[model samples]
Target: MEQASSNHTLQAEIDALKASLQQTNSQLEEAQYRLEEANDMIEAIRSGEVDALVVKGEDGHQLYTLKSSNLAYRIFVEQMTTGAATLNRQGTILYCNSRFASILELPLEKVAGSVFCDLAVASEISNCNELMNAAWVHSGLKRELNLITSSGKEVPVLLSLQAMQLEEGLFMSVIVTDLTDQKKQQQLLKEKNIALQEAQETARELNANLEQTVRERTKELYSNQERLSRILETMAEGVEIIDTNGHLTYANLMAQKILGITQSETDDHVYIDPKWQAFHVNGSPLPENEHPMAIAMTSGKSVYDFEIGMQAPDRERFYISINAAPIRDEQGTIIGSIGTFTDVTHRRKSIQQKDDFISVASHELRTPIATLKASLQLLGRMKENPDPVMLHRLIDQSNKSLNKVSVLVNDLLDTKKMSEGQLQLNKTCFSVAVLVNDCCQHIRATGNYEITYEGDKDIMVEADMDKIDQVLVNLVNNAVKYAAASKQIKVRVVREGKFAKINVVDGGPGIPQDRLSNLFERYYRVDTKDNHYSGLGLGLYISAEIIQKHGGKIGVESKLGEGSTFWFTIPLA
Candidate 1:
């Protein structure tokens, strides 16, 4: 019984000890909690969150006011490039800087006291709440989200949240960095990277197939070269290639024909010789250095449409249009020149003829007009005087002037009709010899030369009588006009086979053999250095066309100092 009593007393004493120990532990835990709270307050104060402090001093619970640093804080918040705003735990905006208001496109006063979550896109409202709640627990939290503005424009932004314990309440600080421009730059960079990757892939593929592609390209290149050669050979324009030593390395068929070059004559300098005598379009001498090929080689540049008049070795003057370009090696050194040329002789002559015809037509038309005007004026003045003889003379003069104008207009009209294939013919049976005699009557009346008609006067032919008369008259006139030194003109007609041949012979300075081929071409005239004849150069051309329409042939035979025989053949009736 004594052992039990001792054990019970010991147990009660141990239980009291345990209670005391538990109570002491609870006091220590409370003190620790207060210390943590004090530390938090101290941190808040240090961070300028506390506005005032209460201190227990000698005067007991003295209150002191802290100097305001709101100005500095406000300046820092407003001056920040990123948008800054203060929000409550519920995500209600309490204050916002100018930048924050600008990001939302709203006024600071309007944004304050507004729910910040309203600015977040509808899809991101829940995400914004989550971030805000997390920020309250965690000091710093960040998220990328889209915010909707008053104008319905969605702006991408980086929202950085920081919770602060201020004197007033626990508020969250938000930093909104606009990512619009950054997003655009990132998109652009992504596209460029994709392009670069594609290019790299293509390069790898090309490298892998390089050998086969090269072989195929080489075959195609040869085929193209052969096709090009054939085209160059058949093309109308002349093409020639010269080496660096000024030697003709290659000449197409057209080039050889145009330059009158034989296979053995391969030297380029032959053309630059004094005998060739090249001249510029302006009639100035073209030196060897001035030739298009030479200029292109020397200057290492191209020459375009350089017109030059070159006299062939046969003394035939012709014009050529040349285009030349320097051929360069892989090192960009001019190796030689490749030149193309076209025979522009006919074009050049045609141009000159047109210019001459214009000048001649002006003078011819003006002469008759002036004479007619003067005659009319004189007749007007003599109207009241009534001088019969002067009146008759003036009337004749006016008639002659009008006739000249009529002839010129008719020639132009006839030429135009022939060119348009609109010339109509009225055929009839007529005597060739009779037609010649009648046509020469006017020239015989002039008495400037002796006109003789010796042919089969009864030789009949079916043809347009008026057109035949015109051809005969034209031939006689040409003989009388060109054969100034000669005193005789002869017209002959004869029957050969089924045709009657007519000939008009002249004895004067005859045409050059070189000019006979182009005699009947339109606008072609015999150029005389001493005198310019008064005509449109259409007589021979018209005569040729008329003879052709009558199913006949017309031509001229002439020698330099001898004379000319202009003849035509018409089928018999």
Candidate 2:
């Protein structure tokens, strides 16, 4: 029974083992069939044969579907205006659109499988490599670079690269765009800027030239104005310019001096003011309207030799002669007036003196002529039966009259010669003491006064002896005539340093202070109402001239009540 039981157990074990092996073979066949179906499905999907798939899960039955959309994507990329391409991770061109091949001037077959970096210009290959490396980390990379076409031409292009990750490997999608139009526009803009700069430079040069010309012209005008001002200042006559309104517009240096107006005091309106005191030639008060410049302006005519007396601000009077003429414009219309002034005080005085001298000389000549005629008539009467003593007295009277006439003629001749600067002197070394004593002897013989001589006995001087004698005689005669009441005359000579001084003192009513300054002037005399003096008033004048010719000075000292002393000094020998 034990053997039979063991056999059954073995048989059971075999049966079980067979059943397990059959189950393992069935599982292997199902795995093989499923893998074949999976591969076949993949192939069908790629070939566009299968369109749908179904998968069952715990939630429910799920349907998964596949569509041939790559055709649409391929069409879109092929028809794009921009070039499109695909690059492997190694930067090799694996696939490219028709537009990409057209841009590079190459066939699509040739563009694919070519190194993308090799298609770029040699200088831009490094840029392309950098772009490809950036594409691995970044989603998109872009750069502007030049591409080398199949014809060996360099064309500028904009390249865009994008990174795509797939189970096969990492790929880069590249897009290229032509940059020819953009470069042309930039070149045009640069040319326009250069042209603008050139135009600005030309304008600056023109402005500089214009400024230089203006400066030159202004400098020339200033120089001319300065020259005109110098000419006006150097003129001798007092010139004044007035406007039509009688206002002084311009005055030279001489004009300011003549008018007694200082530079600080002169103003535009001062010369035309009517407040100044002015007189006409006839001693009547002159009105403003009658002024030379004013009359010239109003009448439009010249006024010549219009004399007027003007009192300066210091109250000193001046005799002025003016000649004024209207200054006319180019149209002949009076615009202003110009006047010239001359001081004529001395000239007028000289004319008056000549008139007075003529009158006095006529009277003097008449008196001498009357005396001579009386003497001649008496001689004629005595011609019949004249007593000798009476005839001698008449002849003596005639001789005295002739001497008086001869002295008068000589005095007149001396005066004329002195005025003409032709008076000649015969000079010698002479004793001043002798000159004084001789002059006093004549005066003492007249017995009009007690004449005395004092001082050095032998004072010698270098002078015209005859002229000195004449001067001494005149002084003594004057003392006798004027101081006869006092009956005293003194003649003195002294050596003062290098000079010999002579003095003639008289006890006479002293000269008036007002008449002292005029004592030495030609033709001047002390006019007394009583007519106590006679003869021409040329004695003192001639005396002064003679002393001056001898290199001497003559002067007087006197008081109204005290006596008069006339003195002179000459260089001692």
RMSD of each: 30.0, 45.2
Per-residue lDDT over 31-105 for candidate 1, one digit per residue giving the tens place of the 0 to 100 score: 999999977885565344774333344555433333333332333345344577777666766566676787788
RMSD of 2: 45.2
* Estimated TM-score for each candidate: 0.56, 0.54
* Candidate 2 segments exceeding 4 Å error: 1-229, 242-250, 268-290, 311-317, 327-336, 385-400, 440-442, 481-484, 528-532
